[model samples]
Target: MKINANEIKVGMLIEYKDDLWEILKTQHVKPGKGGAFCQVEMKSINKNTKLNERFRSNDSIEKASIENIEFNYLYDDEINYYFINQKNFEQVEVKKDIIGEKGKLLKENLNVDLIFHEDKAIGIELPNQVQFKIKSTDVALKGQTVSSSYKPAILENDIKIQVPPFIESGDEILVDTRTIEYIKKV
Candidate 1:
């Protein structure tokens, strides 16, 4: 679908210069002396290259028509992650690089939205929040009571994150998958 540059948003996929690109960031600028333009930084999904481009506000760009399919986490073999469609019992495998750090959060039976373009899996969208147990954390000192202070802690998956000073080891907490930060105690 063709969309005005003004409609572009971060995380959107678009086709430009014969390559699929993922929008990393966008900024709409209305300078005092010139017409408005949308500044965008996009990374090529096919070539893994990045480009910074600006478009006139009225310009149209081809937005990639993508599909999101729900799949349950099956397992990984260090190189790829496997998922299954519960309804059809169909299995699909996606490369580990495409998932990057988020691959560590996958758990058995966890549901995810797999992004596909041209019938090929391109990426995944994990739940915004997931439950994790704090594997370890530094003991909070009673005298150093800073309200905004956070302590570094490790989760059961071995990913480290900062949490409230009061959080302790073995406590279950909700974590934001997008930012990989602590949300609240569960």
Candidate 2:
């Protein structure tokens, strides 16, 4: 899909130079005495490169076609993750890069959205929030109140995350992996 420069927005995926780029920021300027143009900041999907580009107002660009399909997480072998296509029951192995940070929150049998471009897996979108139990953590102090401080805790999968001072071992909490913030006690 070809779109005008003015149509780009943050989080939109675009295809340029045979590579996928995500729009990180965009600004449209119509100077008092100059032609209108758009300034865009984009991050390469695979290479993790960030770049800035300016385009004339009327310029057109190809928008990458991304398909999001729900798949059931089957397993992982320390190198690749296996997912089963819910619609067809066919399993696919997604590389580590595609899983990215979401790999920390993934649990076996969990469902996730497999993002693909031209039938190639590009990203894995985990659930907005996941509940994880703290496998190990120091005892919470009764009167040692801190100002919104977080302590390190280990989860069942051995993923380490910071939790509130009130959290203790054996407690479950919902975490927003995208922001690495503790949402609520579960």
For model 2, where is the 10-residue window of minimal lDDT? 140-149
CA shift at 132, candidate 2, in angstroms? 0.7
Q: Which tens-of-lDDT digit does each residue in 11-100 have in candidate 2? A: 999998778999999999999997999999999988889989999989999999899999999888878989998889988899877677
Q: Which 10-residue window of candidate 1 scores lowest in summed lDDT?
A: 141-150
Predicted structure with the largest TM-score when compared to the true one: 1
The C-alpha local distance difference test score for the whole of candidate 1 amounts to: 0.94
Q: TM-score of every model?
A: 0.90, 0.89
Each model's C-alpha lDDT? 0.94, 0.87
Q: Tens digits of per-residue lDDT for model 1 on 1-186? A: 999999999999999999999999999999999999999999999788999999999999999999999999999996899999988999999999988888988888899999999999999999999999999999998887688889899999899999998899999999999988889998
Best by the lDDT measure: 1
Please give the distance, in angstroms, between residue 165's alpha carbon in candidate 2 and its true position after superposition. Answer: 3.3
